[model samples]
Target: MRYSPVLDRLAGLGGAKWELHVRARERIAAGEDVVDLTIGNPDVPAPADLVEAAVAAMRAGRTQYSDGRGEHNLRESLAARYAARLGRPVHPNQVLCFPGTQTALYAVLMGIAEPGCEILVGDPMYATYEGVIAASGARVVPVPLRAENGFRLSAQDLAERIGPRTRAILLNTPHNPTGAVLTAGDIDAIGRLAVEHDLWIISDEVYEELVFDGVTFVSPLARTGFADRVVVVASISKSHAAPGFRSGWCVGSREFADRLLALSETMLFGNQPFIADMTAQAVSRPSEAARGMRARFAARARYLADLLTQQTALGVHRPEAGMFALVDVRSSGLSDRDFALGLLDAGVAVMPGSAFGETLGGWVRVALTVDDDRFRTASGRMVAHSLSLSGQRAEA
Candidate 1:
C-alpha cells in the first residue's frame, strides 16, 4: 500500500500530541481518575441565545445550501464587526465564511503560497499550522519565540528569516501553548516588515476575545499600510464558547477574499447555512458572554499559576491572556514528554511543550479549560509529581 508523499510529510507533523490525548482518554474510560488538560476544548456551555438562534434558523427553513461565499447576511454582519473593530471600512464582499478557522487558514495558505514557497510561523505555535502548510506543498520556517523574550516574535528575527522564497507569515495572538499576546510594538514591527518584504500576513485572531486582565488585543489588520496584504481569520468558537457550531470567517482585501471564496467553493461549497445564520445572530446581538468567559478563564489561570509557583520548584511563566500557560519543567531533570507522562500517572494530563515546536523541549503547556475543582485537583497532582521527581534527583 502506498500513499502520496504529502501524507508521509503530515505523518511527521503534530509531534505525537494526539497520541498522548488518546492515551489519557483511554485511561479515563477504563475507570482511572484522569485529570485531562491536554487539549483547549472549552467546557463552558454555549450561549443560550446562540443555541436558540441555530434552532430558530432550522425552524425558519435555513437548512438549504448556501451561496458558495456563505450567507449574504452573515458576511455582512462580519464586515460590519470588522469595520468597527479595525476602524477600517470592510465590505461584505471582502468577507468569506468557513466551517472553521483551520479550514480558512488552509484555504489562505493554499491560495497564496505555491509549491517550494515558505511560510514563516512563530515557534511554539499551534501544531495544526505546520500540518496545513505542509499539505499546501510549502515549508514552514519557524521564527523562534523564545521564553526569555516572553515567547513574542521579534522584528529582527522576522527580517532575518524573510527571503525570496518566503511568501507568507502566520501570526497567532494570545498565542496557543504559551498564552503570549503580541504587544502593540510587536504588531507595528511585523506590519512594517510585511510591507517591506511584500509578504502576505495570515493573522489568526481566534483568541482575540479571550485576552485576560486589562490587556487589549491589537489585530494585524489594525496596523497601517498592510491592509491589502493581511488576511484576518477569527471565529466564535473561542469567543462565544461555541466550537461545535463550526463557524468562522476570513476577512481581507476584496480580491483576496474572492480567492478564499473560490477555494472554499471547490473544497466545501459553503459553510452550513443554519450555522452561518446562528453565527450572525451571535455577532449582531449585544452580549456579555465573552466577558464572562474571559473572567472565568483568568481566574482559573491565576489559581493554577499560583499553585505551580508555590508548591513546585518549576519556573512558571504566567500567561498574559488566553486559556493556557507554560511551565518550565527542565528542573525536574526529565524531558517534557517524560514529565507529562509522569504527571498522567500521577492523575493529571498536559501537553508536552515539544508538541508545539522543538525549541520548547523543556516546557509543558497547561490548559485552563477545566472547571475550578478539576483544575485545583490537577494542580495538586502536578505539584506532587514535581516533588517526587525532585526527590529522586536529590537521591541520585
Candidate 2:
C-alpha cells in the first residue's frame, strides 16, 4: 500500500530532535533520578473562571456544531479584544477560531501558499514550522536570526532574501527557544517589505501575552497599511494556561477570513463551542495567571543565566519572554545535541537548539516551566557539566 507524498516526508517530522529528551524520559521511567526540563507545559493551571465557564457551557449544551468561523459571541469577544489592543475597530468577521495555533497556521498556509512557492521563516524558529510548510507544498527558506541581534528577525535580512518566488513571511514574536520579542520598529520595517513584495505575512502570536518586563511585543497585524497582508494566529494556551482546551483564533482582514472560512469549514468546522465560550471569557479581561508567569519565568531565567555564567563555561542568553531559556554550549566544544546527551547523563534533560533550526547548533534550550526546586537542581547539574568542560579546556 502507498501513502500520500506529504506523509512520506512528515513521518515523525522533526521528531529526531527529541531523541535525547525521549531517552531522558526513558531513564526516569526506569527509576533513574533524571531531571527532565525539556518541554514547556505551563507551570500554572487554567484559571478557575475560565474552567468554570467551560463547565457551564458544556452543561448548557455548547457541545453542538458551530460554523467554521466559530460562535458569533466568541468572535465578537476576540474582535473587541484585538480592537482594543490594536487601537482600531475590528469586526467579528475578522476573527476565525480554530482548535489551536498549529491548525490555524496549517489552514493559513494552505490558503496562501502552494507548491514551488517559498515561505521566509527565521532560522531557529519553532520546530513544527518546517513540517507545516512542507505539508503545504511550499518550501521554507530560512533567514538566519543572528545571536548578535538577540535572535530577533530583522527586516534587512528579509529584504536580502525576498524574491519573486517568495510568497509569505512567517513571523513569530516573543519567539520560542530564543524568547526574543520583536519591537514595534521591527514590525514597521518588516511590514513595509511585505507591502513592497505584495507577500502574505503570517504572524504567530501565541506567545504574545507572555512577554517579559521591559519588552513590548509588536504584531504585523498592528502595522498600518498591511492589514490585508497580515494574518495573526493566537490562543489562550499560554495566556490563560488553558493549553488543553485547544482554543485559538486567527485575526486577519474581513476578506481573508471570509475566504478562509471555506477551508476552515473543511478542516475542523470550528473548535469546541464550550472551549470557544471559555476562551471568549478568557480574552475579555486581563490574565492574572499570565502576569504571574511573566514574573516567575523572568526570575528563573535570570537566576539560571547568572548561575551558569558565574560557575561554568556555559553562557545563558536570557529571554525577553516565554518559558524557555537558551544556553550557549559552544564553549563546551560540543554540538547542541551532544551537549544535551551529556547533560542527560548529568541527570538533566534539555532540548537541543538545533532541533529548532540550523542557526542554533551550539545552543540548548531548557524550560522555565519546571518548579523552582527542580529548575534549581537542574541548573546545578548544568553548572557541574559546564565546570567539567572548562576543566577539560584548561587541560587541553
| Strongest candidate by lDDT | 2
TM-score of each: 0.97, 0.98
- Clashing residue pairs in candidate 2 are none
Candidate 1: lDDT of 232? 88
Q: Please give the lDDT score for candidate 1.
A: 0.86
Tell me the tens digit of each residue's lDDT in model 2 across 1-396.
988988875777878877877898899999998888898889989989889999999999999999778999999999999999999999999999998888899899999999899999999999899999999889999999999999999999999999889999999988988999988889888889988999999999998888998887777787768878999998888988988888888999989999989999998888888888888888999789999999999999999989988888788899999999999999998889888988899899999999998999999999999889988999999999888877887899
Cα misplacement distance, residue 203 of candidate 1 (Å): 0.3
lDDT of 1 by residue, 269-311 (tens): 8888889988988888544667876887788878877888888
As a whole number from 0 to 100, the lDDT of residue 187 in candidate 1 is: 89
